[model samples]
Target: MISLLLVDDHPVVRDGLRGMYSADPRFEVVGEASNGAEGIAMAVALRPDVIIMDLRMPGSDGVSAIRALAERGIPSRILVLTTYDTDSDVVAAIEAGATGYLLKDSPREELFRATEAAAQGETALAPTVAARLLGRMRRPSGGGLSQREVEVLELIARGSTNREAARRLFISEATVKTHLLHAYTKLGVNDRAAAVATAFSRGYLSHDNNDE
Candidate 1:
């Protein structure tokens, strides 16, 4: 059985996940946490093979908590289970070392398979999310921003808020949100920080000044 930990703020959600894993003979829900901090603690103490993580939390939040774990070089793999969003948290989580992203509403079977895949060092994302991102990449615009919805992504990497990114890009916030969603899908990351990090690691964000 693949040992796993479930982390989410809602007791109901955690309970549901626990129940789901209980039915899957290949998985064992070894521990649980209601927030990122407790999740980190449980992760350190139990050393689960994979962590099913919600991207938001009260105290430590998902991304920072993941980063803390990574900084400590813990070997546990992280699988993000969150609603679709393109922002700092998702980006930061991926940058911090999460292995995969899955929508919280993904069918329980997919979640289970994803957890199993993660244990073997594989990655997965929701299909619609992946398609949307790929469509943007096939766009005909020549500027890096052309084919890829990059202008807002640049702001994302610089730690800009959605409103700030919209204003800087001369687009409506809703439009910016749309672009962010697409970028998140394409980058195969759940949040802006992770998307940016993936881009950087993949050499998409090439810049001479590393200070920014």
Candidate 2:
């Protein structure tokens, strides 16, 4: 059976997931955690084949939990199951080491299959989430923000306009704009200021440079 650890803040959700997994002969609910902190502890102790993680929680939070589990060398594959599918949520969770992303709207069978795939260390993305990731992958930056895109954002963080950033980076202004656009898409921001702020918050840019 594919062993699973259910991690969500809501007890009702946990109960529902537990019931679903417990009913399936191919899977088992090995453990349940009500928050990200508890989830991390259970993950370490249980070492379930797959962890069904929620994106938000009261304490450690889902992204923090995923990053922590990966940092602490926990080998359990994490499959994010949440209601939110925004670029920030999906991108952050995947970058934090989740094996897959699935929305709560997904059919019960899809969730079951996603858990199975996650147990096998496969990528499982809901249709919309997959499209978002696919769009990011198709951008000039591709997947995560490219090195050039990050450099552009770093320059912008220092109050450099597109022309100035291009002059500094020795690239054409058009190229600089392209990089910023890609950064906007990848970082899920609408404008240059938001992009720069998000880049800093996500460590794409250094916070030490507070110059505006």
Candidate 3:
């Protein structure tokens, strides 16, 4: 069974999630938290495979909580559950280390699927969230990204698979992954879109930009 930690300030919200997920034989709710701080503490103690977190809380918001988890090197993946639909919130949550973000009104089945995907380290973003993330990429960054990261980010932005990037770079996929991981950490972003955003925001993708 995949253990899950549900964090939300609302008792009814948690209860609803618990009820829906409990129906699936492959999932079990290991714990619940009323705020980000409590969520972090309980997560360390339980070590659940996934955490369903809320963006807003009384103490230590979800972004801060996610950042804390990433800094601590916690292995559990996060799936953010928030009411906000703005691109900034979606991007910010992802940059803070959330593997996925779903609105509170997400269908029950989608929520379950997202949780499962997150447990396996696969990304699952709501359609709106995906749209917003893609929209952020439309803006030009004016060559603000770094050299090595630019190479990887452009390939990633072109929808090239990581395996393809490894082959093109004449490096092992693991090495490519290492570079991408470092890029992710240093860029304060996760997943390809955020990395691309960071790269463009830093002007690394511009043709006139070159740094070796």
Candidate 1 scores a C-alpha RMSD against the true structure in Å of 11.6
Q: Write one digit per residue (lDDT tens) for candidate 3, span 1-212.
A: 89999999999999998998899998999999999999999999999999999998997889899999999998999999999867568878999899989999998889888888998899999986786677457544553334566688777777778899888878788877887887787777878778876676654453333322
Clash pairs for candidate 2? none
The C-alpha lDDT values of all candidates are 0.78, 0.88, 0.83
What's the distance in Å from true for residue 208, model 3?
37
Candidate 1 lDDT over residue span 1-212, tens digit each: 99999999999999999998988899899999999999999999999999998987888788877888898888899998888545344456667888888888799789878888889988776664454445445543542333336667767777789899888878899998888787777666798778777766544553432346
Best model number under lDDT: 2
Residue 154 CA error for candidate 1 (Å)?
Answer: 18
TM-scores of all predicted structures: 0.64, 0.67, 0.66
Question: In terms of TM-score, which candidate is stronger, 1 or 2?
Answer: 2
Each candidate: RMSD: 11.6, 10.2, 14.6
lDDT-superior candidate, 2 or 3: 2
Whichever of 2 and 3 has more TM-score, that candidate is: 2
Tell me model 1's lDDT, rounded to 2 decimals.
0.78
Cα lDDT, model 2, residue 114 = 90
* Model 1 misplaced regions, further than 4 Å: 87-89, 132-212
